[model samples]
Target chain A: MAAFALGWLALWELAARAGWISRLFFPPPTTILLTLGRMLVTGNLAPALALTLYRLALGVAIGAGSGALLGWLMGSSRSVRLALDPIVTALHPLPKLAIFPIFLVLLGIGEASKVALVALTAFFPMVINTLAGVQQIDTTHWEAAANYGARGRALLQRIILPGSLPLVLVGLRLAVNGALMVTIAVEMLSAREGLGALIWLAWQTLRTEELYAVLLVIGVLGLASNSLLELTSQRLLPWKGET
Target chain B: MQITYRIAKYLKVVLAVLLLAACTPIGEPATPTPAPVLVRVGVLPFMSNAILKIADAEGFFVEQGLTVELVPFRSSNDFVPLLLQGELDVAAPALTAGFFNAIARGGNVKIALPLTAFTPQDCPVVVVLARKSDVEAGKYASPAQWKGATIGISLAGAQGLPGYVVDLFLRQAGLTAQDVTLTALDPAVQGEALRSQQVDLLYAAEPWITRLLAGDDVVVLSRAEDVAPDLTSSFMVYGPSLLAEPEVGRRFATAYLNAVRQYHEGKTPRNVELVAEYAGLETELVQQVCWSDIPLDGAVNVDSIMLYQEWLHDLGLLDRLLSADEFLATGFVEVPE
Candidate 1:
């Protein structure tokens, strides 16, 4: 896969060098890499990356924590499910960006608004996935837990949580990815820092090479995060076998 | 199966109708009429772009043998890319670091005409507003008081006209950019930000200036005109499509300047009506907001543009400092001696 990626980049570089593509719009990979290196050396990339990651971490934690708790409740109690399902169904399809202005108004145009937007974007996938995770657990497992005298917290800790672990991981992965995306988007709209702001600045200043470099950084960050999540899931769920 | 069958039957009927419509032909005229050259002009619903609307409404484009298509855009970011890509024949956006940067990077777009400027007679097209509460509390009373205060602008990087104006305001008081934090806020929410005390000062343009001034929330700190008199704010840019055909560009300019003459005729009833109709503002609001000056002969201030380029370059927002000749496509319209 690495070789294939290198070959693809080589073709792109060749095309740009050969003038098949407009260099002003699509700089060669080498140019992008060099630009990225310059940004890093010049101490521009690190802070932006760090801020974006920080926002993503905080947003995903808040969103996923609340979403999992509510999802578990919804799955455990039919009354909860019926009440929230309509609200969730109505809201899940609405774009998070549509409500960003409201967040800015409520939270003010600061870090709070950006973080809130990211959290909202991360919330839906986590809730939906976690709800499915809890519902899909076998009823026999619950009965078995009860037979073993497991109740309330004990039942939750030993049976429900462990049984629902796999889908919960899936939910977490989705939330993290969504959180990152929203972080970049909100930052682009109204921020002076982060990869999104860098991208916006590059765009505003017509620094196409710099824009491409920031985009590459974002892509790598996404890939690295997903890999880390996958490795973590494997370690947490060894019994699931090769997942 | 029944649903699929019904869908297929409906599709067949639709296709039959389409085929019938396609086969039907209208006879051509005996004399072949020359097609008017189509120019796709991108515009934002701002007072600055009143000339494009005036030109269209007054049939100036028709007189020039051009078919003008006014494409509305939300922001320069939206239309700049399109203009670069040749999707838009012309665009009139504020003179920004981005536009200069594009030209430096070999984007086949050139400043065709001066769109708007700050003149003595006109109200300030852009202004710096301080929070009313802050002003009442004896804060931001003068430029010296702006030290360590947060100023909200529509764009960051200090690369645009507002940034230059702010810098001018700062320098007059021996203050610099480091003394105050310049935060970028959307123009739509700038009033709210100031009202909520998110930022101590706002660099705003009309009709936002008019609307914000309506309430007692913000007090005018400085007018851009007072700071930088005769400063050019925006320009009409010609993309590759228009640039490739000099005659078409010249014709467009001719019509545009004709409209500029009408615009300079002041707020006539017809002019106000056209501006209101084009800008999607009420006639009263149209009359209320301050308008920028467009040169009667459409002559650009070359020195002013060069000064802006130097400022951006000095600020490190622009990598290449462009010469006036490199970006300005002159001789499209007559410049006064």
Candidate 2:
């Protein structure tokens, strides 16, 4: 990973230096770094960066938590699964961005709409993964827990949950990335602040350098958040990392 | 066990804090060290040799201590917001709609030079081209029959520019926009649409018109000049900021006008190559597109601005009706001593 990043940086700088490519069209990696440093010196990153991560966390958490619970219920109840599967399948193909206008119109283009859009983008993967996880979670595990006097909530916590957690984590990673994508997308559509808006406003004014600067900031923030989430999943399921 | 809960609790708290913090104020980028006094100049493919080649080559802008740049756009909308925001210094922008949108949006851009002076009998720059079939069917067989039908003007930003009203000679042939679908095809895609019969009428300016005329299948339905005997289609404009920096504004205008003069006189093969480079066209194609749309002598016509104000108002684009004076941007060329 380090080598890939370093090699890309070297190539970018060399191209700009050699005059093989116009720096105006694609600025040097160092120029981006210099701009990023200036942004940091000015303390421009923290607020928007924090907001993006926060939205990702909230969206993924809600999507994962709800999807897991609902998936388990559907797995246990055949009737419930039958009713929801068609509905889920029916709505799955709609373009998430195309529906943003509906959200904006209904939700009035606030944080509520942005959060909802992020959640909407995230919820699908979590639900689908959790469903698969729950179906494949052994039936014997629940029976064994009940036989040991673990009932209801105790059965869920002692047996069903741990069995399904690995799949839920897969669902969670997907949701986390989805949440990040939707968060930026919502902001781009219409927001007074955030990295997407920053890129967009710069584009409107033909500030290509400033636009690239904002894009670089968003990329770093996204990578950092995803790395943090990966580290979290490793701690939550230590054996998975070893495997 | 306590540490695990504590970590989760702190994580939740941090997450919530981050989300809540998003509600606060953001600092805008402080004015960076002034860039190389970059002036964003909009250039069309037609002016590639006349305007763009000079700016790109010949070091003309360096003399003015300005870095003249071209924002080659297929439509005026791309330039409109930047021009309004004081991002662009000069735009050899296309005339849109009945109203001057750039000046209306609080941008201080004015006519830097008059391109294509108006004459009563001269062919206007903006015109409606229809299939000879549509024109002869009492459909505008020629520029004379363009009224009362919806004509296709390529690009969304152009639709609002009143190309329909201006070139059709304000004849109001009873054709509402609904009568003809003003399909929003980009000019590059126009040939396909024309071949497909998707658009019955097309509003094209010179060069595109001249190029289409080159083909035997497409006939000159109308010269934009035939429709309106006034309001020449081409113009150069600079907003207040650039104009206020008289030294900067004059240099760009002078270099640009010099380039225009160069093309009118004729370009060297090298100069032709430079224009073609930016135009993304071959020399033969560039020659076809460059025969006209000349950088003629005249200033921004008051009549054109008035036409825009009046027509855009009728189109319900403006809240308060503005007169020609309200739209005219000043500080262009000084009057004779």
Candidate 3:
């Protein structure tokens, strides 16, 4: 993987130096790295990265928690599912960014709106995944636990939750990624600081090298975050064969 | 049959070779003429873009021997980066802190032409707006009473032009930034914010101002010109590549100046019609909308730009003040004799 990436970068560097492409329009990897180093020394990237991660954490926590609870309820009950399925289907296809203006009016243009946007984006994926996870379980799991005199919380704790754990973990992972994507997007639209703001500002000021550096940081952070989630999910769901 | 086919193919090849030789020069190498310079201009769909649009519409660019492409941008915020990336050869975004910062950091972009200036006339460059309920309630009865009021701006802080309006207003009213709240709100929702009482006041430019005034509940408290007079708000900028080719830059300037002259020939019916068409407004609204004051010959005021930069530094928005020579592209604009 490293070799493949480096080979392409090397070719780009040669082409840039040979003047096949203008440096102003597309800076080489070396220039982007140098600019990234400068940004690090200036303390520009630290706070932005921290803020973006913070927003992602808060959003994912709120969204996944509420969505899992609601999805489990709907999955367990016929009337609840019938009532919410329509609303879910209608909202699922709608882009979250389009409703940002409404969010701004309701929540005000501050941390609240940004967090809400991220939460809202993550919410849909979590709801859909959790619902599917619960419904996918065989009725035998529920009946088996109830036969042992398990009732209410006991039945839920012993059967429904454990049976759905693997697929629910998948939902949580997807929701976290969704939350991060929404967080970055909202930050770009109206933030004073964040990786998204850094990217937008760099683009606005025509700092091509800085823009590419910030993009690289975001990409690495996203990969690391998704991998961390995968590791945690594996430990929690050992029967899933380290997936 | 086979022999005849082979003979015909060989004859065709021989004839093609002869034609090529006939087209070739016998002696000395041929000198190639340079290709015509193509300029990609970034413009906002606003009345302020009248000069550029007119130059394009009237064939002035073609007359000057330059091919110009005008790309419409939604905001000035998107203009600078594209210009710097060489995707755009020219742009005329407002003189915000971002532009100054780019220049201070040694970005190869320079102020090329003066696009518009806030004049002494009763032009509507910017205005302070208040809700009718707030006005009637005597909330901001006096300028000093503006304390503790929530003022919505399209962009807040030293980076935005409205921040200067806040500065001038506070200075006039004997207040400071700490005395009130300044929130960055979208101009699209500024009127709604006022009507809903989400914000106490706002600083907005024309069209929005005109649209908001059409409602019974909004009133103009003051004009930006009255507070900060004779200021050049926005101007054209060019990347280094455009400047490196002296003749291309001159031709662009010449064509632009001709349009500016036509714009300033005193808003006749035709001029009003052109403004209306470009700004996407009715002709009557165009007449009511105060046109920005620009120099007839399109010369940027370097001293005013210096003063603006000093103010930006004082506000802590700019790290360092760039000298006039460093900021301005001298000799780009040829003064009309």
Candidate 4:
């Protein structure tokens, strides 16, 4: 995979250098990497990256925690499920960025509004996925756990949690990715600093190399996070087997 | 045998059709009527762009053998790339560091005519306004008082005309942008920001300025003209397509300057009506707000533009400074005697 990636980059660099594509719009990879390095050396990239990660972390924590709790309740109780299902169905498909103005107005055009937008966007995927996870837990596990005299918290801890671990991990992964996306978008709309704001400024100034550099940073961030989640899932669910 | 006969019959019919088509007279020869040169103009719905509308409405473009299509755009950030790519033939975008940077980076666009500027006698179209409560409490009565204040502007960073105006306004009090915080807010919502005290000062222009003043909650701190007399703010630019066709560019400029003459006629019923129609406002509202000044001769202020470039370069906003000859395309139109 690494060799294939290098070959692809080499082809892109050659095309850019040979004038097969516009260097202004699609800057060569070496140019972008050099720009990225310069920005880091100048202390421009770190703060923005740190702030983006900070927003992503907080938003994911709040969104995923609430979503998982709500999903568990909705899955365990038919009344809760019926009550929330309609609201979720109605709102889950909403384009989160479309309602960013409402969040800005409500939370006052500061960090709170950006964080709230990220959390709201991160919430739906988590809730839907975790609910599916909880619902798919085998009924036999519940009946057997209860037969062993387990009740309430014991039955939840010993059976429901163990049974739903895999899908819960899936929900968490989705929530994190969604949170990162929303955080970047909100930052682009209103923030003074962040990877998204950097990209926006670069485009505004017609600095294509800087734009590509920031995009490369964002792409790497997404890949690293997804890989971490995948590793965590593998470690946590070894008994589910390689398949 | 049947298939061979069928193929022979089809070939005969095809040959006959081809021979008839070859012998047909396409049309009678006559004097050619040249189609009007279509020019795609990107414009924002602002009074500053009234000349383009006036030119179209008053038949100046038709007289020049040109067809002008006005494309409405929301922001320079949206249309500038199109302009650079030659998708837009003409646009009147505000002077910005990004524009200079784009030009320095080999963008095939050039300033063709002057559009709007700050003249001493004109109504103050652009002004700095402070919250009424702050002004009354003596918090921001003068430029020196601007220290530590959060000011709202329409564009991000110190890269555009607003930033230059703000810098000039600050220099009067022997202060710079470092003494104040600049916040990027949409012009439509700037009044709300000032009213809600989200920002202490607002660098804004007409319509918004008129509406905000009518509410009695914001007071004009300073007019932009008072600080930088005759500073050019915006100009008409021609993309590569228009530049390549010098005749078309000349005709477009001719029509544009003729419209400028009409624009200077000042609040005629016809002018007001046309401006209202193009700007999407009521005639009364159009008459109420201050209009921007476009020179009758359509000559840009080169020194003022150079000063803007130098200031932006000092702020490290521009990648490199562009020479007047590099960005300005001359000889498109003659200066009035």
What fraction of the correct interface contacts does each predicted structure contain? 0.62, 0.00, 0.16, 0.22
Task: State the displacement of the C-alpha of residue B125, model 2, in Å, after optimal TM-score superposition.
Answer: 5.9
Docking class of 4: acceptable
Candidate 2's residue-wise lDDT over A152-184, tens digit each? 788677766777778877887788777777788
TM-score of chain B of 2: 0.70
**Model 2, C-alpha of B322: deviation from truth (Å):** 3.6
Worst 10 residues of 3 chain A by lDDT: A199-208
lDDT of 2 by residue, B31-148 (tens): 6643456887766666432465665586777655677667666555455455655667676655543225334434455666665543444344455566766545665533334434
Once superposed on the true structure, which residue ranges of model 1 sit more than 4 Å away at CA? A1-3, B1-34
Candidate 3 lDDT by residue in tens digits, A1-243: 999999999999998878787665578889999989988988579999999999998888888888888888887788999999999889978899888888888876668878988888788888888888889889888778768999778877877687778778888888887788888888777776899978776665456678899999988988998899789887878878767
The total of clashing pairs for model 4 equals 0
> On residues B174-239, what C-alpha lDDT tens digit does candidate 3 reach at each position?
998788887667776778877777778888887788889989889988788887776777888888
Better of 1 and 4 by TM-score: 1
Q: What is the C-alpha lDDT of each candidate?
A: 0.86, 0.62, 0.80, 0.85
The candidate, 1 or 2, that scores higher on lDDT is 1
Candidate 1, chain A: TM-score?
0.96
| Candidate 3 chain B lDDT trough over 10 residues, lowest sum | B154-163
Model 4 lDDT on a 0 to 1 scale? 0.85
For all candidates, the clash counts are 0, 17, 0, 0
lDDT of 4 by residue, A1-243 (tens): 999999999999999999897687878999999999999999479999999999998888888888888888888789999999999999999999888767655666567878888888778888888889889989888788878999779877887677777888888888888888888877777787898888878887778899899988999999999989888888889987642
Task: Report, to 2 decimal places, the DockQ of model 4.
Answer: 0.24
Report the number of the highest-lDDT candidate.
Answer: 1
Instruction: Supply candidate 1's per-residue lDDT for A126.
Output: 87
Error of 2 at B234 (Å): 3.8
Taking all chains together, the TM-score of candidate 2 against the true structure is 0.49
